[model samples]
Target: MGLFNKFFKGPEIDQAKSDANRSKMRACFDQAVENGTEYKLAAGYTEDVSRFNYGLVHGSKSKIGSLIVGWNEQNETIVVVPTTPDLDECSNPVYYRRSEIYKAYRNKYPTDAFIIYPDKKGYIAINIFEWLEDESNYIYIDQEAEAKAFTDFFMNHFKTK
Candidate 1:
């Protein structure tokens, strides 16, 4: 069954389980004093080098901003939340099913590399633009190790999707 296991796949995860996990996580987050800081997955994240000045390129209109990439247990999809102030305050977070991610890679900068993916939007540009001086451009996947962990988990999870 080793070959079959490699070619085939396991059954889909149960929706009930996903919902229960989401509920539990949400409860913990709600009870925390600092919800924003308490989300340890992305504590001191700043930017993704691959997303540098993406909006400045052609075929782009929307300015890039902050991003929060995390797993949404309730929906069983990757959630990309825009944290830029004022710009996307009224906008809803973007959800990407495993099938929606066309490609995923880690582009290297001078000393760091970051995860990048493309969806319906042009490119997954994080913290590449700012309209105001004090606008936020933080990414939760901060360090190279963290980025690698996220990339590995994401790639493995969607390898068959």
Candidate 2:
């Protein structure tokens, strides 16, 4: 019975860990937003696209950290908070305004801006660009439904004027 269950279930979801991570993310978001209203939040592993490779030089994906993205309604901004395993090494929260996000969405070079697509490992990759620095990063979500929800929330807010 144990073997059968293991085979059928694959692996059990770690509810406790998930809850803890969510709490940490909420705290970070609150600190960044202050009194702003939250529209959406999603958790995933993040990587800098520039440093990522296809396993030729190094690994296919170089994960910098785990992160949670939150949409702040009060200031019309998107806040990304790093929930890296190594707390001391975590980067600061990055804020992207609605206008800047929209500009990236409508960029002349589509590959140079915000885009979401499936990764080689069956995860969903959401790419976000920092226009000023010309840098791009990606968040890889394990669940397709969650990725869709995140993308939908982002598009609804930042895809238009």
Candidate 3:
């Protein structure tokens, strides 16, 4: 079996069980909130960023910007709402070029690694693993876990690690 299969290889979740997990996710988001930040679902959150929007030298024409739903360490999940916006505020949302903030973070971090595509309806594989394992930095997976639930079904509905 593959990684995804192994992860969810257990029995398929029944509707009731799935619904319950969904509810748990919902409650998790109710508690967390981001005060001020330009968040947009992104494009090319794939393992390989060489793809469109990601592989491009610029981002204006690329698709980015997603909705954040919930994130919590206690529950071990990051919730987000998948989005397909016409623009990405993080960048030129309009032109899709690299924004000041994006550049800063990308420069500061070793690599602009991402696990989730905040803009799309799926979990983005960000540098959470690095954040957790690396001693140089303290990555708080919990910070985003609660936010996962608040996101739409696309971002929500995920298994715990």
TM per candidate comes to 0.39, 0.55, 0.23
- Best lDDT goes to which candidate? 2
Q: In lDDT terms, how accurate is model 3? A: 0.30
**lDDT tens digits, residue span 1-161, model 2:** 99988789755545565456445556666666555345466655444545445566754445454566666555667666665542223356667776544242323353323343222233223443211111123222233455566566666766552
Q: In model 1, which regions exceed 4 Å deviation?
A: 1-64, 72-76, 85-90, 110-121, 126-149, 158-161
lDDT string, candidate 1, 91-122, tens digits: 24455566676655445463233344555455
Candidate 3 lands at a TM-score of: 0.23
Error of 2 at 157 (Å): 2.5
Error of 2 at 158 (Å): 2.1
Per-residue error (Å), model 2, residue 2: 12
Report, for all candidates in order, the number of backbone clashes: 0, 0, 40
Q: Residues 8-39, candidate 3, lDDT per residue (tens digit)?
A: 75544245533443343333323232421223
Q: What are the lDDT scores of the predictions, listed in order?
A: 0.41, 0.50, 0.30
Backbone clash pairs for candidate 1 read none
TM-score of 2: 0.55
Model 1 / residue 135 / CA error / Å: 9.4
